[model samples]
Target: MKHPLSQFNYCPLCGSAHFEAHNEKSNRCTECGFIYYFNPSSATVAFILNERHELLVCRRAKEPAKGTLDLPGGFIDMGETAEEGVAREVLEETGLIVEEAVYQFTLPNIYVYSGFPVHTLDMFFLCKVANTDSFKAMDDVAESFFLPLNEICLEAFGLDSVREGVKRFLKR
Candidate 1:
């Protein structure tokens, strides 16, 4: 049986391209019996706070929720730590350098866009800006601004991941 969602060219354990459907939920390599589970990718995100205590937010220019406000964060690359991913994503999206950051929370959610399921283990962090004056939008970011926490509205940004992350930070 073939899983409707399973698509693989090789066995994850043996790196062999020859594989056969073991069942509706798994595949077995012809060379080695290795099963690959359909799972979500892990992502790391951050809620950056400047010296003035203003939360830094960006208007997303890309999908998965375009034209919406979000925190300066993104996917964690392979072999990269959560902290590293948070810093890199913040810089890539907002060009803001983070001075210090601490792990906040984790959310396991499915991001569905255009009929594609994006399973993500989202790791959230609280980051402090090293140089607030140098912050600027780089790529996949239409605009960036620091807003008072109280002014943040859920209606303006439909992404509950961001809203929830910030709200959690504020409460702590």
Candidate 2:
């Protein structure tokens, strides 16, 4: 795997070509004395189960993992809490308003976006919804459905963190 900052050749702070690796996770610009560190972004995932205990799942409409199975969550925005981000993501992708979200676990993942590896700390949540009647696939989701826990295959999930997360979720 390439370094997360491998795509950069110039320093954004001073437009300096003297930028070089400062350490494993940072780069220093020799001309401007600016250091850029690579850090993981915060993301969220939801494991919503209906009364029958079927987990809600989605089909991705876009890459990184087009047409693969996914959960209803995304990156947490700058000013949002993890609970708020998970709820918003559930609403956006599945049209289901989350009444409550309980934090479960977290997993570190490398999400490849536009050929760049983005490190993320994916926080998992077990969500609750008051109604499923309004559910419809929206946003980046191609379709949405619920599957029994026994029927879910880890390999069907495209994202590594999600796959591992689901495996851990099921075991618990």
Best by TM-score: 2
**Cα RMSD (angstroms) for every candidate in the order listed:** 3.6, 1.0
What TM-score does candidate 2 reach? 0.96
lDDT of 1 by residue, 1-172 (tens): 3333465677878888887677765677889777665766888778777677888888988787889988788788899988888888888888778777788888876666676667678899888877888878878888999998788776676467666766677787
| C-alpha lDDT values of all predictions | 0.78, 0.93
lDDT of 2 at 33: 97
The residue ranges of model 1 lying beyond 4 angstroms of the native Cα positions read 1-32, 113-115
Question: What residue pairs clash in candidate 2, if any at all?
Answer: none
Score every model by TM-score: 0.80, 0.96
lDDT for 145 (candidate 1): 93
